[model samples]
Target chain A: MSVTVPSGFRASGVVANLKSTGKPDLALVQNLGPRHSAAAVFTGNRAKANPIIWSERVIADGVVSAIILNSGGANCFTGSFGFQTTHQTAEAVADALGVSAGDVLVCSTGLIGVGDQEFRDKIINNVPAAVEALSEDDDSAQLAILTTDSVAKTATYAGDGWSIGAMAKGAGMLAPGLATMLVVITTDADLSSVELNHALREATRLSFDRLDSDGCMSTNDQVTLMASGASEVIPVLADFIEALKSVCSDLARQLQGDAEGSSHDIDIEVIHAKDEHDAEVVGRSVARNNLFKAAIYGNDPNWGRVLAAIGTTDATFDPYAVDVSMNGVRVCHAGEPDQPREMVDLTPRHVSVLIDLKSGDATATIRTNDLTKEYVHENSAYSS
Target chain B: MSVTVPSGFRASGVVANLKSTGKPDLALVQNLGPRHSAAAVFTGNRAKANPIIWSERVIADGVVSAIILNSGGANCFTGSFGFQTTHQTAEAVADALGVSAGDVLVCSTGLIGVGDQEFRDKIINNVPAAVEALSEDDDSAQLAILTTDSVAKTATYAGDGWSIGAMAKGAGMLAPGLATMLVVITTDADLSSVELNHALREATRLSFDRLDSDGCMSTNDQVTLMASGASEVIPVLADFIEALKSVCSDLARQLQGDAEGSSHDIDIEVIHAKDEHDAEVVGRSVARNNLFKAAIYGNDPNWGRVLAAIGTTDATFDPYAVDVSMNGVRVCHAGEPDQPREMVDLTPRHVSVLIDLKSGDATATIRTNDLTKEYVHENSAYSS
Candidate 1:
C-alpha cells in the first residue's frame, strides 16, 4: 500500500525471466490522473546507463505518463543497441498507456553491460502483461526492482488533504551525490512540475544524498517523482517540501539498514562545523574510511581512527580542538583520549559517532555501514 | 645491506620490550659524517603523531645527525604525554651520539594511542644499547621497523662514484601523500642539503606518493634522506635524482607487493589525459574504488566498473571515448564492450589496467591492491 496510499496511481510487478532465479523482474507504475506532472534526478556518474539517458529526456518536458523498470541487467555500456532497448521500452509503455513515447521513462538495474536482443525481447514481450496486472492496491512493484537488497523499502506521509508515497531499492554501490538506488515517489497534491522538482531536490539533498555506504556510485541510479492532481489540495510549497522530505528520509534509513553484508549501521554526525559543506565533508570522510568502518565491525571503539579519517578532509576544524563520542561515550576530548575505550560498547547494530568541531553551529549526518569480510566476499562473488 | 650499503653510516636494531613478541623493536641510524646533510617528508595528515611532529622540526635545519625509530606503538593522539615520550627518545639518541637533541629525528609505528610511561621507558632505555651495537654492515634496522610486514623492504642504487641505499616498512594504510611507512635513505654522494631535499621530493612524488593500497592515510609516515658525503664525488643533480628515484621506486614496489592481505598488485595506468594531474586523478580514482578492487580480487575483468570509477573524477576525459584494457586484453573499446571479458585472465598476481583517455599525451600510473576477505579481516582485527 506504499505508492497506492496516494490516489491516482496504479502499479504492477511481472516475471520476465530476466533474473535466473525466476523472480519477478519487471515493474510498471502509471499516473492515472488528470494532471501528469513529474520530476526526476539521475546518477551523477558520467558513464550513465541507457535507461538513464532516456529517462533524463523524458523528465525534460515536465510531463510523464508512466515509468517502467527492470532488474537483472543494468543495460549500461551496451552501446547503441542498449539505447534502442530503452527507447523501445519507453515506446511499449507509451503504447500500453496511450501516451506519447517521450512522456514515458525507463529504468534498469542488475549487472552492467548486459542489454542484448534476448534481454530486450523479454522486457518488450512482457509489457502488456505488466499493464494488464496494474492495480492501486498492488505493492509487488516494490519487490521487482531489488537486486541485492534484503527487503523492500517503502514509506508514506499524510498531509492536510494530500499525501506522499515512495519506494526505494539499493543494497550496495551507495555513495554521495545520491546513493546507487532507484526511487519512485508519488504524490496526490496539486503541484506544478517545477514545484515538485524544487521540493524533490530539497528533500533528497538531506536524505538520499547523505548515504555513503561503500562509497561507490552506480551508472543506473535515478529518483523520480510523479504528481497526479486527483486530490485537488493546493499544498503550501513549504508544507509539501516538508512532507516529501519525511518520506524520503524514511526510505533512506530503510536502505541503510539493509545495506549489503553490513554488520552495523553507523551514523557519523558532525557538529559545530563552520558551514554545512564542511560538516558534510567531515562526516563523509569518516563514512568512507574503511579502517573506521572495519573498526566498528570489530567493536573496537578505536577513536584514533575517527580522528585519522577526519584528518584527511580539508574541513575547517582545528585538529586539537575536536571531540569524538562513540555510542554516547566521549572517548576523545580535544583530540586527546578522554574515557577509556572499554567504556564504549559497539555490539549493537546501530552505532553513532559524534564529532564536535568546536567551530560554528552547522551540522550534518552521514549514514554508512561497517566493512566486513562478508562484504568483500559478496562483492567479489557478484562479478558486477 | 640496506641503509648501511652507503659509506659513513652506522645502523643497529635492539630489543626494546615494546613489542609483545620480544623481537628487535628499536632501531638507530647515525651519520658518521664527513658531512651531515639531510631532508625528510612527513605524512600530510593533519592529525600527526608525536614522532612526526618531532621529526618535522628536526629536519627543518637540514642537519639530522641520527634518526631513531621503534615499532609496536604509533604514539599518536596520546596527548602531551606522547610528545614528551618522543622528546625523551630523541634526547636519549642525541646523548648517546653526542649530538644536539634538536638534530635527532624520531619515528614510531604499530598501533596508535599506545604511548605511556612504560612505552617511553622501554624506548629510552634501548637507545644506548642500539648505539653500542651499531655496525656499518649490519642490516637489522630494516627488520626492526616492520610491524605486520612479512619481510623487510630494501633497495640500493650505485652511481658513478657514489651510492644510495634505502629501507622502507609499510604493510597497510597506504595512500597518496605517502604510504604508512618509515623510510631512511643514505647516500655517499657529496651533495648539499638543498640538493638532497630537491631530489628527495622529486623522487617521492613519483614513487611512494603514487601508491594507494588501502586509501587510509597514517599519522606517523615519514621518509628521510641523509647524505654523508664520504665518497668525495660531486655528482650531477640529474644523475643523483635519477639514482634516488630508482631506489625509491624499487622500495615502493616492494611495499606494494607486501601490502596486507592483498592478492593482486594492480597498476592502474591512465594515458592520454589532458595533463599529468588528470591522469593521476583518474588512476587514483580507480585504484581506490572498492568495487573495482573486489572485482580484480575475484579474478573478474569487469571493465565497466573501471569506466564508472573514472567517470566520478573531474579529470579531462570523454566518458564515451575511453578504452580500458586489463592484462593486455581490451575489454572495453571506446566505452563499449569489445573483447569478451572471458578473454582476459586475471588469475595472475600482477594485474595491469590501461585506460586510454584519448584526450592528450600525459599519463600516470597508480599502484593498489585488490580488496579481499583477508583484507577486511586483518583491518577489522587490527583496531588501529
Candidate 2:
C-alpha cells in the first residue's frame, strides 16, 4: 500500500534466519523509473550503525536505485567487520537488481552491539531471494522493517496529478535522534532530488522529529525518500510539499499510537513561548519526564509534575505565570490550581496536554506516550 | 542517629495527620548554639515550592536556629495560601523554640499543585506539640521526612575533633537538580557561615549531585547544614569538609538503595573523560537511559543500549574507542564486543558499570536504579 502506490516501485519481504524467531526479516524495495532521484536522513547519533554509514554516502548523489532492509541485528558498534557486512549486503542486492552498488541503500534494525556471524550468513544467503520475490506489493516490505511494532504503518496522501506514500516501523527507543525507525517514502511527483530533500526535511521536522516516545535515541534510524517521476505530471511544489508532510505526519502518529507497551498517546501542545526553540525545549523536558508520563498513565491530571519539568529547562517562562490544561480541563491557571483534576477524563487512549508558558506568542508541539507497567515489563523481559 | 550524632542538636517528630497514611509527618530540629551559622542549597527549578522560597531567603542571613519539615504536601503551585501556610509553620516553630522568625526554615514534600486546607490546619495545630517533645532524638526526625521511601536514611562521619551527621529522604524525581531530597545535616565544628557554605557546596557537588535515578528534577529539593559551634572543636577546614562529604555520600547511597520500587542500585563510574563535567554528563546519560536500565533489570548485559545512550552525550570521547564493563566484565571493549555477555552476572542488586571514555584523566560516578515493573506499578497506582 506504500511503495506501489507510487507509479514505479516494487518491494518484497523474505524470511531469513537473521531473526531468531524465523520471521520475515529481509525486505527489498526497487525503484524502476526514468528518474531515480532520492533523498534520505539518518540518525543524529554519533555512534551510527553499519548500514547507516553505508547509506549516507549512497544518498549523497541524490540517486537511489534500490534499498535493502533487515531486522534482528543492529550491526552497530561491531567494528570494521560489521561495516564490511553492510557493504557486501548492498553489493549483493545491487548485483541481483542490476543496479549500481553505489546507488543501493541499506538499513538494519533490532539488537544493538554485536552482529552475529550466523545472522550475517543468513542475510548474505537471503538477499537474492528477497530480490527475486520483489513485486508491486508494498505490504511485505512494511512488515519486514518492523521490530516490536504490533501493526504495519502505511500512509498515503493523494494530490491532483501525483501521490506521496510511506511505510514506517518503530516501537521502542522513540526519541528524536530519529526515534529508532526505518522508513521508505515513494512519490512519482516529477521532482528533483533537491526538491525531495527540501520537502522531506520540512515534513520530518514537524513529524518524526517531534515524536519522542521513550527518550532513547537509536543508532540505526533512517528515512529514505525515492521519487520515480513516473507519473510524468508535475504539480505545484508547495502543494506537493503539503501532501508529503501529511503522509509523514500520518505515519508519525501511527508510530506514536503503536509505541511499545504504551496505554495513552499524548500530544503536548506548548504555546506562548519566547521562541520556537524555547517552546521545544520546554516540550521535550516534559516529554522526557518519566514522573509526568507515569502520572498520565494513572489518569492523574498532575499539572505540578508538568511545572516541575518546565522548571528544568532554560525556556523563557515565568514559573508562576504558566498555565496547564489536561484535555479540556484547566487544571492549572497561571501556575496555580484552577479546575479540579477529576474534571479531566483520561479513560481514552489519546491524551492532550496544553502548556501555556506565557512568555511570548511562539508555539511548538511534541508527541509522547504515557509510561505504563506494560512498558517496563516489556522492556525488562525483552532481553531475558 | 542523624542530627544528634553531632553535639548541640535536639530533634523531635510527631504525627500531624498530614499524610493519608497517618504516619509521622512533622519534625523539628533545634540548635543549642554558641554561634548559629548555617548554609543551604535549594532546587534549581524555577517553579519554587513555598517552603523552598521561604528557606532560600532565611539562609541568606547565614544563621538558622531551627528547621521545620513535613512530608505530606509539597506546598508547590498552591497559590498565595500555600505561601501563607509555609510562613505560618515557620512562625510557629520559631515561637515555640523562642528564636527569631527569620532564623527558622521550613521544608515540605509530597504531591504538588494542590495543598489542602486541612493539611495546613493540621500542621498549624501540631507544631507546638512537636516542639514540646523535642529531645536528642535524630531517629524520629529522620522518619518524619520520608514520603514513599521504604526506610529512613541517616549517615554519620566522625572527625578527630568533631563529627558530622545527616538525614535525607528521596525516592522518585531523582535527577540532580540536587536530586529531589530533603536533607538536614548537623555538625559541631566551629566554622563561619562562609566556611560552612564552602564545605557544604564541595561535599554535595561530588555526592548528592551525582545521583540521578529518573531524571526528573523536583520543585521542593532542599539541603541545609546547620553548625551549632557548641563543640568548639576546629580541625583543619579541609579535614572537616572531608568528613562532611563522607556523610553526604553515605546518605546519598542510602537514598539510591532505598529508591521506590528499585530492583537494582547501579553505580555508573565514568573514567578517563575530558573533565569532571564530561564524566558526569556521560555517566548521567547512561543512568537516565530506560532501555539500559531495563536491560539491567533483566540481568541482560546489553552493552549496546549503553553505547546508544553514551552516543547521545556531548562528552569528549572517541566513539569507537570507548570501553564498557559490567560487573567487572568488559562486555564492550573499544566500542566493540569483548567478553561474552553471559560471562557477566547481574543477579546482585548492586550493579557497577565502568565506562572508560579514554579521552582524559578526569572521572565521575552517577548513582541510579534499574527500571522495573514494580516502579511503574507503584508510580502508576500511587495517586489514589
Candidate 3:
C-alpha cells in the first residue's frame, strides 16, 4: 500500500496514550527543507491554549522545522504546569529531530486544562518513537490530529513548479475570525516569510475566518504554513498565493461539511457592501444567526431571519436598500419580502444567500452549516 | 375567567386577520389616567421597524394615553406602505379611544414587510369593535401579541401603595441588546417621562438586553411603560426605578423560560468584573454561544465551550484569572478544571453559570435558554 504524502513534508502518527481510549492521538510533521521560511496564524481567543501561546512565539522568527500536535487534550487553562507541558513536548520533539527547541511548534485540541504530569511524561517518551516512525507516506498523521471530526481533511494543489498541500481538523467550536480549526500547509515555493505571511493572512480572511458554523472560537486554533524550498522551479508568487488560498478554502469547506450535527452547509454572500470589512461584518452576523441556521436545517428559506441578523451590525446601510436572494431566487427586495415564500427552495444539502447591500462594490462570502440534534447529542454525550 | 389584570390599566384583544392564519392577533392597552406620563425603549437595530419609528417619535412628549399592538405582521420594511399602515393603525386606535392621535403608540410584530393596504384596512375597521371589547379582566390581550410563543407571559408586582404590571411576547429572533421581545408595562405610580425613561433604559439594560436565547435582534422590538398615577402614591423616584427594574427582570425571565423550542433555561452570572459593562459583555457573549447552548441541550457540562465564548469578547480580564461555576459546583477555577465533571448538575429546567472575572466588584446576570431540535423545527417549518 502506498502512503499519501504532502509536498516538501514528512509526517508520522503514533499512539502516545495521551487519550485514555488509546486511539491514535499524536502526530508529527517536519519540513525537511533547504529554506525554512514560515508564516503562521493563531486563535484570536483571549483564553488561548498553552500550545497556542508556545507556537505564537516560535513562529515569530519567520521559520519553523516541525510541529507536534495532540488530539486528546487541549493544554489550556492548566496554569504554569500546562505551559511546562507544552515546553517539554516541544523540547522532546526538538531533541528527537536534532533541531532547535525554539523552532518546533506545538498544538493541542480536546479537553481543556487536563495536562497532568503523566500526560507530559507519555508525550516525551513517545517523541523519539514518533520521529523514528516518520515516513514520506504517512497520511495517518493527518488523521491523528482529529478530536471529534468524523474524517480527516487534506487538500493538495500542484502548480507548474511548486505545490501546496495542507490538512485541517475541527468539527465544532467553529466560528469566524478563525474557528477551532488547525491547519498545516507545506510548500516547496521559494517565497520569503514576509510574502508568505502577507499571503496567508489574506487567504485566511476569506477562507477559515469566513466559516462560522457554531459561532464558537476554540482556544487552540492555529494555522501554520511552512516553505521547504525543495522544488527548483520558481513559480510566480501570485500564482502560489492563489494555490495557498485554494487549499485553505478547501479545508475550510471540509470543516463545515463535518460540522457536528450539521444537516446542511450554508453559504452567505454579502455583495455591494461599503468595503470588505463591512461585508465581513454582515456576512459573519448572518453566519452566526441561530434562527437562520435552524431555518436552513428545516429546509425553510426564512429571509426574515436574514434581515434580522443584518440589522444587528454597525455596517452602514439602509436596511430598506438591501435585497436577499436564496438559491438564485430573490425572496426580498429593498428590505421587504418581494417573492412568494413558497418560491424559495432550501431543502438541498447546500444553501446560498446573497445579500445585495446596494451601497458599494465590496463583497464577501461566508460558509457555515446548519445546527442539528446530532451536534447537541455528540457534544453533550462526550465527557470532555 | 378573571384575567391576571394589573392595576390602573384597561386591555383588549381583537381578531383583525393581520396574519394569514386568521387568528386573534391585535391587542390594545390604555392607562385610564389619573396621570399620563410614559417612557419607552425601541430596538437598537439601526434598521428600525416602522411602528418602532413611530412610537419613538410619539412618546417623546412623555405623555401616552393608549398603546395599540398587533401581531401576525410586523409593519417593517414595507417601505412607504409600512409607514402608512402604522399611521392608520395609530389613527384608528386614537379615534376609537377618543385620544389624540399623537398620544396613541403603535407596535406590530410577526412577519416583516408583509403588511399591505388591505391589512391596514382590516385593522382600522376593527378598532371600534376592539374598543367595545376592552376589559380590565381580559388576559387574552397578552395572548394576542404572540407570534410563535407557546404560552402567554404576564407579571404583576404590588408595592406599598403602588403596583406594576407587564406583558411580553416573543419566541425566536432573540439575542442581546434586545431580542424580538415586545414588552408593555403599566404602573400606577406618578412619575415624569424623564424619570421613567431613565429607569426604563437602566432596567432594560439589565433585563431584556441580557436575554440572548437565539442571538437575533428583531426590527419590531419595543418596550413601553405607561403610568396612570391611579394610586396617587408618589414614592421616591429611586423606589419607582427599583420597582420597574423588578418588573422588567421578572418579564425577562419569563421570556427566557418560554423561549421557542427551548428545553432548558440558562442563567449565566458574571461576577468580579471590571464593571457591570464588562460583566454584561462577558455574559452576553456566552449567552449567544450556539455550542454552549447545544452542550446544555445534550446535558453535557462542557465548560470549554463557555471559555471559548468568553474569549471572543473585548471585555477586560485575563482568561486564566476567570472561574466558572455551574449550578453551585465550581467546575473551573483560575483557568483550570477545578472539580470532577460529574460533580456538576446540568440536567435541570434551569441551569446557572457563575463566572468570576476577579477584576472588580461589579457583576451582571444574563438569561438564556438551550437550543433544541424543536426550536429548529419551529423556525424552519413555520413558513414552509
Candidate 4:
C-alpha cells in the first residue's frame, strides 16, 4: 500500500504505542518538492483539539514541509500540557526533516485529553525512526491515522496533466455541518495556495459537510491538501476543481460505507428549495433525524419522519407543497402520504430521498447512514 | 385511570378506530360550566399537524368549552382533508355536548398523513357515545391518546383553593424545543385568559420544551390548560403560575422516564450561561448528541462527547472555561479532562451532566434518555 506514490511526496507510518490496542499509531508525510503550497479545513467545533490549533496556525503560511499525525489520543481539552505535546510533536518532526517548526502541521485523533507525559515521550523518541522509514511508496501513513475505522480509505483521480490522491479515517462521531472525518490530499498541480484553499473549502462544503450519521462531531476533525507542483503540463482550473470535488465526494461516500454500525447509506436530496441555504437546512435536518435513519435500518420506507424533519427547518416552503420519493417510489405528495409504504423496499444497502420543495430551483444533497444497534453497542462500549 | 377526578372537569375516551389496532383512540373533555378560560401550547415545528392548526386558531379566544383528542393517526400533511377532519371532530364533539363547535378545540397524534376518510368517520360516529360517557372518573381518556408509549402518564397537584391535574402520552418522536408529548390540564380556579395563557407558556418553555429523548420532534404536539372555576376561591396569579409549572415539570420527567428504547434517564444542566437561551441552546445540543447518549447507554462516561456537543453552540463563552460533571463525579474542567475515565461510573439508571459555563447567572436544564437498540427496533419496526 502506497499513500504518496501518486504525487511528489514521501510518507511513513510507525508504531508509537499511544494506543493500548498496539496498532500502527503514528504517521508522517513530507512534501519533498520545489513548490510547497498547501490548504486546510478544520472542524467548526468550538472545542478544538490541540493538534488542530497547532496545525491551523502552521498551515496559515500557505506552505508546509511535513504533517505529523497520530491516533489513539485526541489531545483535546488537555489544558496547557496538551498544547505543549502538540508543539513538541511538530518540533520533533520539523527537526527530523530539517524544516522550521512553523512549517510542520500536526493532527491527532482518538481519545480526548488522555495522553500523558509517557505517551509524549514515546512519540518524540520515535520521530527519528519514523522519518528514516519515510518512502514515496509507504501507504501505512494513511493506515496509521485510523481510530475506530474498520478499513483504510483512499481515493485517486488523474486529470489531464495533474493528479489528486486522498485518504481519510473515521467510523463514528459523524454528523451534518461537518463530521469527524480526517482527510489528507496530495496533488501534483501548479496551483497557488489561495486557489487551492478556496477550491478545497468549496468542495468540502458540498461533500464531507453533508454527512450526518450519528450527529456527533469530533474535536479533532481536519482536512489538508498539499500541492507539490510536479506536473509539467498545467490542467485547466475548472477541470482541477471538478476533479477535487470528485475525489472528496468519493471519499465521503467511502466514509458513509464504513460508518460504524451502519446497515445502509441514505442520500437526502432537497430540490426546488427557496434558496441554497434553505435546501441545506432542510437537507441537514433530514440527515440528522434518528427516526428516519432507524427506519431505513429496519428496511421500512417510512417517509413521515422525513416530513417531520423538514418541518423543523426554516426553509420557506409549505409542508403541503413537498413531495418525497424513496428508492424511486413516491411515498408522499403535496404533503399527504400518497403511496403504500410497502411499495418502497428499503432493504438495499443504499437508499435515496428526493424532496421536491415546489418552491425555487435551489438544491442541496446530504449523505448519511442508518443508525443500528451495533453502532450503539460499539460507541457505548468504547472507553473513549 | 381517572383523568379529571382531581378537579372540576368532565372527560371521556372512545374508540374512533383511527388505529388499525382497534384501541380506544379518541378523548373529549368539557369544562362543565363555570370559567371557560383556557390556555394552550402547540408544537414549535413549522410543519405542524392539522389539528394543531385548528387548535391554535380556536384557542386564541381563550374561551374553549371542550377539547377533542385522538390518537393512532396524526392529521398532519393531509392538506385540506386533514384540516377538515379536525374541524369535523370538533363539530361532532360540540354537537354531542350541545355546545357551539367553535368553542371546541382538537388535537391528534400518531402516524402522519394516515388519517383519512375512515378516521374522520370513526370520530364523527363515536363522539356522541364518548360525550355520554364523560365522567371525572374516566381514566380511559388518558389511555386513548397513546401510540408507542409503554405506560400512561398523568399527574395531579392539589392547591389550597384549587387542584391541577394533567395527562400526557408520548414515548418516541421526542426531542428538544418541544417533544411530541400531548398534555391536558384541568384546574378549578378563576383566572382570566391573559393570566392562564401567560402561566401556561412560561411553564411549557421551561418544562416540556426542555425534554429531548431522540431528537425527533413530532408534527403533533400540544399542551392545553383549562380553568373550570369549580373552586370559587380565586388565588393570586403567582400561585397559579407555580402550580402550572409544577405540573409541567412532573409530566416532563414522566415523559423522559417513558422514552422508548431508553434504559437510563439523563439530565443535562447548563449553568452560568450568558442567558436562558444560550443555556438552553447548549443543553439541547448535548441532549441531542447520539454519541453521548450511546456512551450513557454503554455505561461509559465519555464526557468528550459532551464538550464536542457544546462546541456546536453559538453561546458566548470560551471553550476552556467549561466544566462538566457526570453524575456526581467531576469528569472535565477548564476544557480538559479532570478525572480518570475509570473513576467516572455510569452504572446508575439515572445520569446527570452539570456544565458550568462561567458566563452568567442564568441556567437551564434538559431531560433526555440514552440511545438503545430497542429504540431503533421499535422505531424501525413501526409501520406508517
Q: Which prediction has the highest lDDT against the true structure?
A: 1
Candidate 1: residue pairs that collide: none
lDDT of 3 at B179: 39
**Superior by TM-score: candidate 2 or candidate 3:** 2
Per-residue alpha-carbon lDDT of model 3 for A44-93, expressed as tens digits? Answer: 88888899899989999898999988888888888899999999889888
Candidate 4 regions with alpha-carbon error over 4 angstroms = A172-179, B20-22, B172-179
Predicted structure with the largest DockQ when compared to the true one: 4
Order the numbered candidates by lDDT, best leading: 1, 2, 4, 3
Q: How well does model 3 score by local distance difference test? A: 0.81
- True-vs-predicted CA distance for residue A48, candidate 1, Å: 1.3
Compute the interface RMSD for each candidate structure: 1.0, 1.0, 1.7, 1.2
In model 3, state the lDDT of residue A20: 74
Q: Which stretches of candidate 2 lie over 4 Å from their true place?
A: A172-179, B172-180
lDDT of 1 by residue, B34-127 (tens): 9999999888898899999989899998998999999989999888899999998988888888999999999999777789889999998888
Question: What TM-score does chain B of candidate 2 reach?
Answer: 0.97
The C-alpha RMSD of each candidate to the native structure, in angstroms, is: 1.4, 1.6, 2.4, 1.8
Question: B77-158, model 2: which lDDT tens digit per residue?
Answer: 9888999999998888888888888999999988887476897899999998899888975578888888888888888888
Writing each residue's lDDT as its tens digit, candidate 4 over B1-384 gives 444855679898887777777888888888985788998887778888888888888888998999988887788888898798889888877877888888898988877777788878878888888888898777889988887777889988788877888899885323332235688988888887888999998888778878888888888888888888888868888888898889888888888888887999999999999999999899989988888888899888888888888998899789998999998788888987787778877887889899999999999998889999888888778753
RMSD of 2: 1.6
Between candidates 1 and 3, the DockQ winner: 1
